[model samples]
Target: MIWNIYLIILTYFLLGGIGFYLINRKKDPLVARKSYTKFIVYFFIVNGLFFSITIEPVVFRYLAMVITGVGMVELIRLFKISGYSRKSFFATSVVIFILLALGFCFFATLNKNLILFTFLVLSIFDAFSQITGQLWGKKKILPHISPNKTLGGLVGGACVALASALLLRKLLGVSPVSLLFLSAGIILFAFLGDVAASYYKRKYEVKNFNDLIPGHGGFLDRFDSLIAGGAWVALYSQLADI
Candidate 1:
């Protein structure tokens, strides 16, 4: 456990810290940099809370409920403020909220290590995508939805995310077969999640979700991939019977 803690810290600093800096430090006003920095802080805060509350299972559920509550409120506000009022959309929101909130809490309660490690893997994918896209991306995959996303970045992110799954296989305690599944999950779903968020942003013409997280836009902005990825992971775990 102690050594694993060290490993987690080292991985966060090496991959997340250096990777974020390399990818985001060239901005003119440094908004990206500030956002990346706050992401680090937010990461710690969330994981700290997760680990600390592991002793009481209900605490995790409570936190999940609180998050869902906030999300519900945010969705309502978004619809109202954005001048969108549809009963079916609101119903869809309720369904999504239930699935996400309960599913995430179930994972955290089931295996802290798995869930936390999954997050790190997502970060690795995101960092590489951002870095590779900015540095060498040429062919835009779908410039309409997300201008910055490129073919190179998507390929690079997937490859690196798969590589990371291999490297952290023992830490995550999965076999070669399971590794393949999760690698695909992290890459495919994470990309979809991010792009989905980007599409919503484009549709709404909103720069940042809420500016609640300093440089990271809103809580939803920061957790977009995690939200999508978590639901997928939970479903996969159940379906695979693993």
Candidate 2:
């Protein structure tokens, strides 16, 4: 688990660097140069620390949650410096972090089977959403802000997520109904995350979140769905007894 987490963080940092370079290539030379370097350094430091600390036992999950919350606040501040309003952006980030913390606490004592299922469902769905959105998107699903998102992509992503969850459930010998419900919850919350990110970008008149990912966006960009989906899955898992 520790090595897996480390590899994931490393991959994120590498991809983020590539995205920053590509996006900065055609922008204001000075601002691009400064912002790209600063963003990469801050993102690496914060996320590296986050991933490292989060691999501890469940007792330390709260600390990881707090670290992630603080990192999110810093991200909001960066967005504010890039011309976003501190009020709404910070408020949203706080709410999201709080919800995530509460969700973690809620499932802390739940059955490991259910908890693992919830986590797997959300992770797979969130990843599927982004991959599908980027690879095959054409018609705008939410044209006002997220013009790149397509209806077809959403369907494709959702199907893939659902399928992945079912496959994992079967492989792990878990409850199929529980997996399906959890997958459904994740899909719903992932959509909410996508819209929330879109709304945030539109409110601030920004194209992408920090230009940190090639064809993707920032940490928030990739993480929005995961955060929301994870929160929802945690809550649902707590409520359901499977």
Candidate 3:
């Protein structure tokens, strides 16, 4: 089990390094630098998540709380920037932070393997969705909300993510039936999370949730999919007993 975790970590960095390097190649120096920064920060974020899960459940719970607290701060800032009234902000914040807290708590109780699987699916889908979208996405699916999301990108990313899930079934010890549902849940929720965040950004007239993570904008900006997708995975794990 431990070896498998290390393997996933190795694979993540290898693929991430190659992908970022290729994408940054031939780009303007400043642009490439920004891309490099994004990649570095992303690496840290991914590893931090991995560490949180691999450690004791109590540790994971505390880490999750810290993350939720930071996320709430960012959300509060967004609400203030958007001029939400105090009542509205407090109400919305309670609802959102509650859901976010529950999501993280549920996630902490998941089987380590399942947690890793959820991460794998989200990472692949998130990365490929944007890559294919940029390379071949012409028709904007949500132009007003998320201008860059396209049908081609969504389709391409889903296809690749599904394929990868199947290919990793044996390694991950996931049955085919469970893999199908899990993959679907992760992809759908991840997309919804992205769209949901984008909706707020558009409505608030903000480019990102915040500028906390440099190129990644903020915790919400980067991990919205994980929050939503992980929650689905946790609920599905309970329901399906996977």
Candidate 4:
């Protein structure tokens, strides 16, 4: 598991560096440099610590959450310097941490089915959202920000997510009812997360959260869905177990 985690981090950094180079090629050199710097710092502080927390105990996890919460606040503050102020962004981050902490406290004993379902729901939605948004998106889903997003893409992504959930259920032996319901929740929340990230980027007058991935945007850009999806999964898993 440790080796797998290390590999994942290495892959993320390598991919992120490629994105930085690509976007930088078209933009002002100074802006690109700053973006890369921000990306690395943000990735290390947020994702690095996050993975560490996952491998640590509950105490360490809480500490990691606190750090992440602070990091989110700081990132928002940085954006605000450019003229964006959406209080809900920070609020949601806080709420997510709170919920996750609660789950750790209460639901750690639950069956892996609940956890697996949650992860499957999140992963399917996230993968489908990106795939669909990239391929079939047309009309702007949010014109003010994230102009590339489309209603068609959203629907397509949801359909893909549903199909993926069903497939996972068949292969992984998850309950059909649970898979269906979880997939629905995942689809809705994944959309919410994507839109929210778009709003944040637009409000800050920036394109992509940070240039950290090759063919992808930033750490936040890639993981925005995971943040919300993971939190929702943890909470839902806990509730279901109860």
In candidate 1, how many Å is residue 151 off? 2.2
Candidate 1 lDDT, 37-133, residue by residue in tens: 6767766755654464444655655665665566556556666776785657556756765676667666655566566557667767876777677
Best by TM-score: 3
User: Which is better, 1 or 4, measured by TM-score?
Assistant: 1
Error of 3 at 127 (Å): 1.9
lDDT of 2 by residue, 1-242 (tens): 43553464466456546655665678798877675656556554445434433443364355436534644764575566766556776677667656764665555445544444455555545444544555566677688877767776688668876876765564336477766777888788878876876777677677666665443456666556655765686677557744
User: lDDT per model, in order?
Assistant: 0.68, 0.60, 0.77, 0.57
Supply candidate 2's per-residue lDDT for 50: 46
lDDT of 2 at 191: 81
Greater TM-score among 2 and 3 belongs to 3
Q: Model 3 off-target regions past 4 Å? A: 1-5, 55-57, 85-97, 170-174
Candidate 1 Cα misplacement greater than 4 A, ranges: 8-12, 15-63, 85-94
Q: Any residue pairs clashing in model 2, and if so which?
A: none
Best by lDDT: 3
| Residue lDDT tens for model 4, 39-75 | 6664555454444334443544454355345436545
Query: Candidate order by TM-score, highest to lowest?
Result: 3, 1, 2, 4
Instruction: Tell me the tens digit of each residue's lDDT in model 3 across 165-189.
Output: 8866764576798788889999999
CA-RMSD of model 4: 7.1
